[model samples]
Target: MPRIKTILMAGTALASVLVLTPSPAAAQSTTKPKAEEQQEAETSTAKADRETLLDTITISATMINEAVFDSLSATSYVGDKDLERIQANTPADIFKTTPGVGASMNGDDPATAINIRGLQQYGRVVVTLDGARQDYWRVGHGSGSFYIEPDLLKAVTVIRGPVSNAYGSGGIGGLVAFETKDAGDFLNADEQYAISEKIAYESNGEGFTTSTTAAIRPHQAFDIIGNVNWRDRDAYEDGHGDEVRWTGEEVTSGYGKATFRPAQGHEIKLGAIIQRYEDYVTGSSGSTSATLSRYDADTINNTYTAKYTYFDPDDRLLDYAFTAYHNKTKAEQTQVWPTSSIGNFRYYDVRTTGISGHNSSRFDWMGLAHTLTYGGDYYYLEGESSASHFGQGEAQAYGGFLQWMGHYSSWLELIAAIRYDGYHLDGETKGTTTTPPEDESLDGDQVSPRFTVGVTPFTGFQLFGGYSEGYRAPGLQDVFRGSGAHDTADGYIPNFGLKPEVAKSWEGGVNLKYDGILTESDILRGKFTGFYTKVYDYIETDFTITPRMTDNIGTARLQGVEAELIYDLGWGFINLTGALIDAELIDTDNPKYKGQPLENAPLDKFSATVGFRAFEDQLIFGGQYLAVGEVKRTQRSSGTNPGQVDGPAQYSDAFELVNLFANWIVSENLKIDLAVENLFDVAYTDPQSAWSYTSDVEQGKGRTFKIGVTTRFGG
Candidate 1:
């Protein structure tokens, strides 16, 4: 508590000093000539055209809309053009080149789990669609997963690390914000309506996808958009030309949005999304044994949202936005393999409802341009499972935050924020003869603070640094799980007294933006970041004792460096991204096992992409190369029995892949795309995948060819 108070005080004091400082630019602001200002605006527009990447604005980092390149924290943006160029088939594909980000997915399941800076699962990383949180969890051999169709999204913004604490609670690792497509994305300014149809096919999986989108502007104040997509795929062969079982599935999804403008400054948007998946999944996600359990699974997800905003240039005090949303995810499975459990049914469901609102007021304070923002958010989650060992529970979280952003002399900027978060969890566990049924509950609260400063010492370069804190409450499963036979050697004991995890992070970075560096029409933009984070009360499963239980393990330290760079000339572009990370678990009761590398940590990765435009920008082609480092892990033997081998050491070999893509604009209403993935047909496994085991790492898809065609028309 004292530490929290000290941080708050320091932040407030720093903000005051920065805002009160006088600057020459502020005093001379009114003296700038109109002709010079106009020239500056034109120069900005010309620069935007030259930069092929990160041309979009991002609102996830500081809640203030700004270009990703200008953000002080490590942030990445994927716009509609990037999405179209990638032709992503899964959520993982969308982030292939993003630094410090890794995704793990089971071979048979469409769900995905994201890892950031070696931290993942149980709300360490927050995923949101249209500002609605996706809270779904199921007990398995790997990390928890979420479902989202990449086709429905128009943009994705990623904010890495706890600097995003103001966005919400429990995002100690990072935040991934997804923005769905709307009427504005498809309809032109002068068009009243429009329709688009797209069809795509893949060779390796024999996959096919059909999509249709329609947008209409019935009145000057109202607009509506709808889209439907269906996709099907067969089991795909690996590089060895052997089929990977349960790798195929069918998916259907639909989305709709209606926007209303009742007043000049007020707007409202109502949206709905639905997705259904049918496939065969395995009981043990990563296991390679032939006798592993198999199940026929059907999953459905739905989300509804309403958002309202009021923004008027004349009213600086009323730049306000509010959103309310509800989401539900349900899955049904029937055991089909493993004779003993054949015909058994399992069901899982989770419902999340949340509301968030914020208002920003801008004004000049003490010769500085300042913005003060305040907001509060609340969310409730309920989950239930038919599996005996999986617990049923309810959880609620609420938080409020206040932030101040100040700018001086067009060269210096400062940001300070404080947030308070509280959570309550309650659940019941199935008990055995040795342990009676018990109802458990827990509650906790914390205050976290953040501060950042940036200085542009030169015209095209900036140096920035910040310190932030984040909090994550324990999950319901961690507190309520209590189903095990006490007499048996294999059992899990429930620990209701578990503590929440807290993260303190420090980050520094440099941003570079230059135009006409080498040629008359060339651009270069890049950001390099280094970060270190220490987590207190890190939670993990403890196997040192009989009746293994979940507990607060100890402190964890993670440090890493990430880099992203893009260079664009008129005819061609080059993009590069890479990350190097090191992490360890420390302060453990067992000294011999201390300082071991954390399990499931992603390996070092680097990517490079080069592309060229031809035929007056109508034809575009590109190729990408990715390299991943190797990882090796040795399982620790049981403490009770010394020198006993628990399992073989896990190892994943280093690998490289190359891909090529092309897009051709045939006419105003027609376009075509082609891509080849894994061009060399390399046989390798992703390091952090659920199917990556010591004996047999799941083989990635072999060389695959994809093609798509789209036609659009409007009246």
Candidate 2:
């Protein structure tokens, strides 16, 4: 295992160093050259675009806008061009090359759960779309899951670790924000109206997709955009030519937005999104046992948002934004198998309403530049389920935060922030044949703090370190929903004493940026981070005691190193990303469980991409290589359950994958894309998947080819 980690890190470093070495053309110039000379020598527009992207400003990390290359925390930004380059089909595809991030979903379902570092589930990782939070969960094999249409996204921003606690409460793990396309993204500078249509096909699942977008700028003060998409797919075969059951699905989604500028310094925007999914799933949705059930399922997700912002170029005292949003997710299922359970119907529904506002003030104080920001947010959530043991409750959470950023001269920077979070939960425990239902309630509050400092001793280089704290309140289900045979020997017991989880993290990293490093028209940029996090009062299920129920487990420790590097020359570019992590639970009462690797932890992985631009940067081609490490599960005896030892420890073998993608701009109004996924067609299963059973492993798709065409018309 140590050798593997060494190899992964060494390979990434070697590749980057080799790419940074000067070429024959660059070596011919012995003296320093002018910036204009370098710009004039650039022939590929893609190179310039890449440099600009590296400077893209992001607001997810510290709530203060700054470029990803300069942010003190680990941050990543994915723009529309990056999405198009990868030909993303699902949300997981968008982060395939990002370090310290993992996404898992069942082959038969479209819902996805994201993991950051070794933490997941129950608000650990905050996910939002257009400022509306997505907090839907069920007692299933996987953790909390969310549904979204990737085709509707214009950009995505991710901040890893609790350093982003100021973004919202319960984001002890991190934050993932998705921004949808607007009218300005579709309409041309001189056009009053525009329309775009796209069609795509995939060979593996025999999938088909059609999307249409229309935008209208009726006047200088107002604009609107609308989009609709439909997709369908059949079950695809695995690498071994075997059909994976219940993999087919049909989906329909729509998005619309309107923007108005009421005055010179005031703007208002409203947006809505809706998605529907239909599919067949086979499994015990609430259990991890091998026994399964079959069902026909239909799901719908909807979100609505309104935002107002006021910013005046002449006023340095105030920059304000206020937003309100609502989201709802509902899933209906009907049983199909087992004569006794036939005709049974189940449903799960969740609704969330929230409002948030913030303002920033900039000024010069005592020979230093300073920015002060303050914000507050509140959300109300309600969930109802037809199933006996599923979540059925209501929860409300709110928080207020203040942050300050200061700069001294050109080399020293400092940031400090603090937040107060509170939550209230209420629900009723299900009644059995011999017992009546009972109402339950719980409440908690806490305060967290963060501080950071950065130094630049030389040009194009920076060193930064920080310490941050985050808090996560217990979920409604964690305090309610106890059900069983009504006997202490065979049922679940509610633990009203369950405590919230708190995370304290320490991180240090370095940032590197250089223009004209190896060539007059070349650029190199990179970020490397090392983080250690200790979670107190970690929550988990305690099966060792009778009447199994959730409880606050012992402390957990997780540490990892992540690296991302990008090198772009005139004609081509290279990207490398990798992460190695170690995680374990400590001070557990159960001796057998102590020091064991977390079941939800992801394996070490590395990715590399190399691409070339031709025909005046109108055509692009690229290929990606991915390698994932193996995972081993240790065996443990099932306490109190005699004659039934827990299933043998399972081993998930390591795997390798290859992919190729290409895009062509045949004309200003037409574009084409082609790609091949799983190029090697190796039979393998992702180690991060939660659906794997002792006897069955969910296999990934086999070799597949995809093609897409898009056209635009405007007037």
Evaluate candidate 1 by giving its C-alpha RMSD to the native, one decimal.
7.5
lDDT of 1 by residue, 539-574 (tens): 876656656667887888889888887777768887
TM-score (all chains, Cα) for each model: 0.91, 0.94
Q: By summed lDDT, which 10 consecutive residues of candidate 1 come out lowest?
A: 1-10
Candidate 2 residue lDDT tens string, 511-629: 87777766666777888899999988888766556677778868888899988888788588888888898877887776655786766675688888899989988998999998888
Candidate 1 ranges with C-alpha deviation above 4 Å:
1-48, 51-53, 286-288, 434-436, 483-490, 634-648, 692-697
lDDT against true structure, model 1: 0.82
TM-score, model 2 to reference: 0.94
